[model samples]
Target: MATPVRVTRLCRLVGRTVSSPSARHRQAVSLPARTCFISTTTWKNLLFKLDERTAHSSLDLFKKDTGVIYRMLGLDPTHVQDNPERFRDWAVVFGNERISSGRHYWEVTIKKSQEFRLGVAEAAMSRDDCVGTNRCSWVFSYAQRKWFAMTNGKTVPVTLVGKPDRVGILLDYEAGLLGLVDIENPRIIHAFKAQFKAPLCPAFGLWDGELLTHSGLEEPEGLK
Candidate 1:
């Protein structure tokens, strides 16, 4: 007979402060009731695709010939002056697979870009909604030479010294833990622990002549 999975729910409190480049300060807020599950079995990476239907402000971005990578031009001053609202912020794309439970991992290759956002969002999130700015999503963004983790419309600075060419994401759904890892050094850059209330989909945000490539799914070194 197979062993049963165990689910654990506890009241969890998490807090952090957000700092802006202009020396602005935001207070730390607390999250509650995080859920976790204990599992001994190894989890494998799941294959994913960029869902065009769920993307926002991405009419101009182009997918490369490989079909696994997407590219977009950097912000243009001339275009911004003519139409400020159209391309003022990041363009977003979401993964097709929605994860409700179990542990999963994936990698993204970001090339020659200074700004980008990578993470997961609720499966039901609106096509027009921006990830990391709402309660249903958790994201890590790099902009202006700084890194930040955003949730519930709040942004918290993530302290890391180096920029990574590739980023790895590990989502322990039942354990309610999200981790962002550096592929080159194999070190965790940041981890967000919270009670995920809904199914999650992989998400990416890009702008400023950035090319974001999805590596599909591959088992990490020892997990296989």
Candidate 2:
């Protein structure tokens, strides 16, 4: 059976602080390229910024809990009630940038890693849905001392050599691949391949503990 997931939690509480945002809903940052690449096993050097889409109305609880005055004040209560993008049963944040082409690399460090999910989702991914449960998203999740690669409502168990403090994500957009790496041990935990159809946003879900993002980084030399 596919592992049932609840996209809810403390609601995306950890990330670098940003300036107070406007009341209007924020959109994904546009990418410069649209051409996909031919599939290749060789990785390329890439760097990209990764910032949380902090204006989300669904993250009010997180703001309140963390006492981030800026975010608390920035909450659009009106939008919370009617915003089509507001998540009713789940809480996650997407990166401000979108990926439509080229290769991209980033890593997330898990602090008190109890239960968290990280991966990519199309910009149009349903606010009411969970990542990896639909065609529009793919993820690597760790929960209950177990790890799995999930997408399209299917789950594949991932066996690791040891607990990893950081997980690396490699997205080959045109080549259609998503890989999760065990940074400490320098090994791939799992990878998913597909013909990506739309621009993707970095997506994260956390219930307890923190997931810190490290972006605009060199692709790990060991993974090359």
Candidate 3:
């Protein structure tokens, strides 16, 4: 979904994504507005320095196997993952910044996207979101602790919507723009903000019209 041309085009037109992020693109490379401030030293973190190393690592992810990642579109996983060129169009809006107010920039993005088209769900936590609209998406059920991804369209960006440094991850199904948390037991769909868990099944495919079936989706087979 992300290409160098696309990333640049979106960055130029869409501008910043996260409603409120620690590190932000400023008109003047000085500091963010006071209302955008979190603390006195917040500027230090907000104004994150995008060094070559950090930039390199983010790019590396696109090349690495990252078995945990699953690209539903392209029909093949290698099309996105293991292919750095695919992500060139994407810009690291937030490399690693702390948001004292919102649920980190990633979470903020998840929330915003969810509100715009979809929503987040987690039983323990009220609700969380990550990743936004994708070219496509296909929802499915979790059966184990294995990482997962899906699509409802031709392609959708699946992003990890967890805090900068925390476990208990979930996928922001951009195609569907839905925040889906993996139920510890794999058979529960946790509500994003309700912090409540509901019993689900491993074969619980997304609702298809008035019917429930795994019709147009495939399992997250990870890297080749």
Candidate 4:
């Protein structure tokens, strides 16, 4: 098992939360979980897992998939600006997958994005609040050429040896751990130790560029 790494020296960032959700917002929240998947030749690969043999033998673990790819579609592009479920005035969205047990791993390709936040948040987290700015979520964010680990309005600066193009996320629900990895550089960015009390969905907040998700991945050897 991978050991949990605790984030330290956190300082509070200014934030706000909405106590009550509107009826339309509540309705949108009730929509069934939607996951995006693309196929090449075979398989209905919305989400995937590796077979024992391939998983045990692979060195290029992140790129090698079992003929399937899972993607995350953020929101209705036409209605994104007016979307009631958007996080306050920000462009934030959550993936449909709700994780409550065992271990899970996924990656997000940050394509030309100048500012973005990626991580997990409780399904019931307030849409009016930003991810990692409250107790219900945890995230690793990049803005203005700086990196941070944030939760509950607290932010911790992250020092990285190399820039990240693709980020790896590892969630061990039972262990109450959330780890963020820098894939290109093969190093851990930060890990938040928490007593997760509810099911979590992949949460993201983006400003300028695209965020592509690659799911159904095995935990990286370095994380182990």
Task: Find the candidate with the highest TM-score and give its number.
Answer: 2
Worst 10 residues of 3 by lDDT: 200-209
Q: How close is candidate 3 to the true structure, as a TM-score?
A: 0.19
* Window of ten residues with lowest summed lDDT in model 1: 9-18
TM-score ranking, high to low: 2, 1, 4, 3
Model 4 over residues 57-176: C-alpha lDDT tens digits?
101122343221212332233332333444443345666556666677788877557677788888767655667767888998887687778888777777765456778887777888
**Model 3 misplaced regions, further than 4 Å:** 1-58, 62-64, 67-85, 91-164, 170-224
lDDT per residue (tens digit) for residues 100-208 in model 1: 7877788776656676778998766643345676678888888878777777666767887867777788888878888888777676678888998777778776644
TM-score of each: 0.65, 0.67, 0.19, 0.64
Q: Is candidate 1 or candidate 2 better by lDDT?
A: 2
Please list all clashing residue pairs in model 4, or write none if there are none: none
lDDT of 3 by residue, 1-224 (tens): 32211211111112112233233331112222223322325532122211121111122222121101111121222223332111222221112222232121111111111111122221111101112212211232221212233322222233433421111222322221223433233321332212212211011111111111111122222311
Every candidate's lDDT: 0.58, 0.62, 0.21, 0.59
Give per-residue CA lDDT, model 2, range 101-187, as digits (tens): 777888877755577778998866765566676788899878778787777777777777556777899888888889997777666
Write down the RMSD of all candidates, one decimal each: 12.6, 8.3, 19.9, 11.0
Q: What's the lDDT for candidate 1?
A: 0.58
Top-lDDT candidate index: 2
